[model samples]
Target: HISALKKGRFWITPDPYHKDDNIQIGREVKISCQVEAIPSEELTFSWFKNGRPLRSSERMVITQTDPDVSPGTTNLDIIDLKFTDFGTYTCVASLKGGGISDISIDVNISSSTVPPNLTVPQEKSPLVTREGDTIELQCQVTGKPKPIILWSRADKEVAMPDGAMQTESYDGILRIVNVSREMTGTYRCQTSQYNGFNVKPRDALVQLIVQYPPAVEPTFLEIRQGQGRSITMSCRVLRAYPTRVLTYEWRLGGKLLRTGQFDVQDSTEYTVSSLSRDSYGVYNCNIINEAGAGRCSFLVT
Candidate 1:
């Protein structure tokens, strides 16, 4: 069994009951062993207990991978530890063509282990920040065999700083630079075993809010109405940071005709009592918030 280091290799297990080789009976233990080797795809793994070759059973399993966690890594999982399970377990790795000497690790399991636990900072969700700012999302993970940390987007794929789009990241802290509106959403931090264990991993979530200027559009670009008929002109704010229109300015041609405050809605409407010669012109509605201002205009006849 590998020792639990705060920062080091990957080890995954579900509700591990011991730390290192000291495991309690009637519990589960997963030993993740990795070796440095080339042509990892051609490497195979074998397990032996007390010098006897071991095989997979209902309570025991062995798995090997080339690129999952690293190049040459394997996992030996023994469940429901009992007195009979106490012994020196050895893992042997050998290349298919027998190019290099076989590498092995011996783990003495007497019987106890700690399971992994994951948590996030309180009230850290809905993290509000402006665009172009850098942000870091973190998670607190603790376990006997410290689990691997994986960062991921709860709803979409994450964009890494290196321009690679991936569903998950191995780094413990997720740093996003020059943030954009597309980065707004929920981010999930979870305990990962990479490719080692097949048990359910613990997870937590935090949200990111990217604030920016508002974008607006006119409900009607152009309208034609007969004289003596009333008409309503409306402007819709497409998107904004503050999300509230503090001030609204209605201008006829180049002069401001009316001004008011709208605190409840993003959309505002102006009603022209009667369509007359003086009312027939280009009317503009400008909406202002703390972040920025946006305007929408329409022509009337």
Candidate 2:
């Protein structure tokens, strides 16, 4: 007799990524948050400071690690700590099935006027693109002393799989040419306080959502999951971008598989919840995103 299969869940690691520091205003600061979940790719992150949502800009920044890795991680950074930067910072990790977890810290930021005021123009909402298209993200940094501009990804490991692509303009604009689906992730606009003692450290963030209409149909393959006893039929749709906006549903031998038709793991990759000889059949995976709709069928037997 075979034991029953288990479902996935979400959780987080305890923190004080680093103890909060009491620093003078001209200085910079950093904080990190770590979270883990089975099939971690489904976890979405949101950061907060002093009870408010924090967005990337000259004064604030956030980034994440590849979820496919163990104990996926996220970060919170205050580029050039300002008087207004002092407060409690929080990191919230959420799952679509409804579970949520978070961690918080109190950062005692001291005051200083030596560092000039650092500010960045508002970041536009994320843009949609097809494979092989070029995208440009622009930001303007304004301050008393002209500051140096820099660019980085919120999730470097996942976004820049091919290493650094040097397309930065002298101004605060970043451009990508002949882009691939994997190049999608949040990009940051940052500035340097070259005024010797400095005035302030500032940064900003923008999101790039990539959408690839199915390059190839979905295919089924057997994968190892348990102690050599359990296995799954994996349905993968290649080159799907902006995966967060895509919807997935399953079918067997041309018949629609409802939510309760059987236990299943729904994601960019569809996995049959239970495995048995009886589970073999022609499987169809359906995906829909702004780019368009895609469907694929494969025999598991």
Candidate 3:
């Protein structure tokens, strides 16, 4: 003879898991619940938020462990979380054997009240600039509650100079006196704001480039004569910026010769080797800079 097995409903104790402290915004977190019921038959689990039933969707899922092997364990998973999902979560499980289990989860989602905004003037150019040249740049940004602005160049923070002679118009403006090429480099601006327990820092970068006229003077001038008395005069230019195309004009008694009479090389140096009697007389060189032009005359006997 065989004895009949007893079947009865079993209760699963509530198991809740959540963070005790508040979490920061843009952070990922997990909330879990574990419960069990004896003789699990036709087990069904439902999740709720603050007494409201949670609708089944791709964002939420409920699964139960194998009833024949690991009876009475259910899990609820939420993925790709967001700030709006923060609230109370309740897990309720029902079994056909008249058993039930309840679990509660308290979720605290961090909130950020301030937005990030930062701006830098001349964000595309180098820092150090040439003196006597106008520098144009801009800095403007938008954010919640605004943000404090700070500027720096070449790792050094820029601030208003302290002195009675310092003019008020220089505030918030980056200026360099007699700027040289050595002053060139990176420039950065940072903005930050604090809202309640949240703090955010944003930054903007700019390259400050200084432009100025050339400084170095022209080098030696020499005359090179090719085969068949084809004469070519050349001048060497040194340390010149904003390179210009050079032009050569041959003169007989100060009268300009025709272009067909001689050939002139492009700027950096002027050369006219194809010399005839028309290419000889008195010659003069004209050099132009960003500021103005200078003229030097040489006599060709």
Candidate 4:
């Protein structure tokens, strides 16, 4: 005859990541729970916040180390500390074998009221890109009361990703799709309120450079010049990237008049000395860059 086995003893302890660290806004807080069980492999952990079940998210992370590495240890990491984060967190450890009772432990995390501080990553700012590309301008904020983030242009109103023309955005991230030259400028990230401790560092700046193909002004120009007189035909190249390695061409009567390359020039000009009747016809100025080409016509009468 064999006797039945007695139930095993189990308990849970609240663990703190560090004793010297204080709860503060914009700081990471981690609460750990350690469980003592007969068969640690059969242990399962669940986390809760303010009586509601909690899962891993961008700001909240739940992790449990392997039983071999750190047996029966689980961690709850809260990032970018906020006022609402001050609450009771419970960790429940259960056994799959069902021989022992479940163990539950609660840990309260609190923080002193703090003001908002905003900062943009240095490497992420001063964004440079060509046309037709999507970009994101991210600004991070930390405060006890969860400050609201707004994005806007320093010069004018902002155009959000949703096609809504607003002065500011509350989404924190300013996403611009199919970027164009018009969208190039200084953008300001501002917060709604201060954290009340005179923590007034509430704004940041981001520079955006949108480069595109050459754009020519006055697509068509008409001029009157008599025979035997000299004339100059020119076209202005609008703000374009890659100012170097630009190729310019002059055409007349379906024939190429002159071609040359330029390093830096706002406009390209073609001169005709002692103009003949053939030169009085239409003259075309074509400019080509890595982005694209721009063409303009001059009607020399």
Task: Give a tens-digit lDDT track for model 3, residues 214-260.
Answer: 33233323444443465444433344333453333334455654322
| TM-scores of all predicted structures | 0.53, 0.36, 0.35, 0.45
| lDDT string, candidate 1, 1-301, tens digits | 1211111234545444444433566877777777665565566778899999999888888877647656567777887767898787788877776746777767655533355577777766678777788887777676544556766668876654456543444445677888888888888887766423424678888888888766888634989899999999888877877675467799998998888887777678889988888889899898877756788889897
TM-score, model 1 to reference = 0.53
Poorest stretch of ten by lDDT in candidate 3? 7-16
- Model 1 accuracy (lDDT, Cα): 0.71
Model 1 bad stretches (over 4 Å)? 1-9, 12-28, 34-38, 41-113, 156-171, 195-198, 216-236, 248-260, 263-287, 293-301
lDDT ranking from best to worst?
A: 1, 4, 2, 3
Q: Give all candidates' CA lDDT scores.
A: 0.71, 0.54, 0.44, 0.71
RMSD of 1: 9.1
The alpha-carbon deviation from the true structure for residue 301 of candidate 3, after best TM-score superposition, in angstroms, is: 9.1
Quote model 4's TM-score. 0.45
Sort all candidates by TM-score, best to worst.
1, 4, 2, 3
lDDT of 2 by residue, 198-301 (tens): 22346677777777765444444433443324333344456554445666667877677742221232344456666576556777766766677566666654
Which candidate wins on TM-score?
A: 1
Q: List CA RMSD, all candidates.
A: 9.1, 23.5, 21.2, 15.1
Tell me the lDDT of model 3 at 264.
Answer: 41
Candidate 3 — which residues are off by over 4 angstroms? 1-116, 120-131, 144-148, 154-179, 192-200, 219-233, 244-284, 287-301
Give the better candidate number (3 or 4) by lDDT: 4
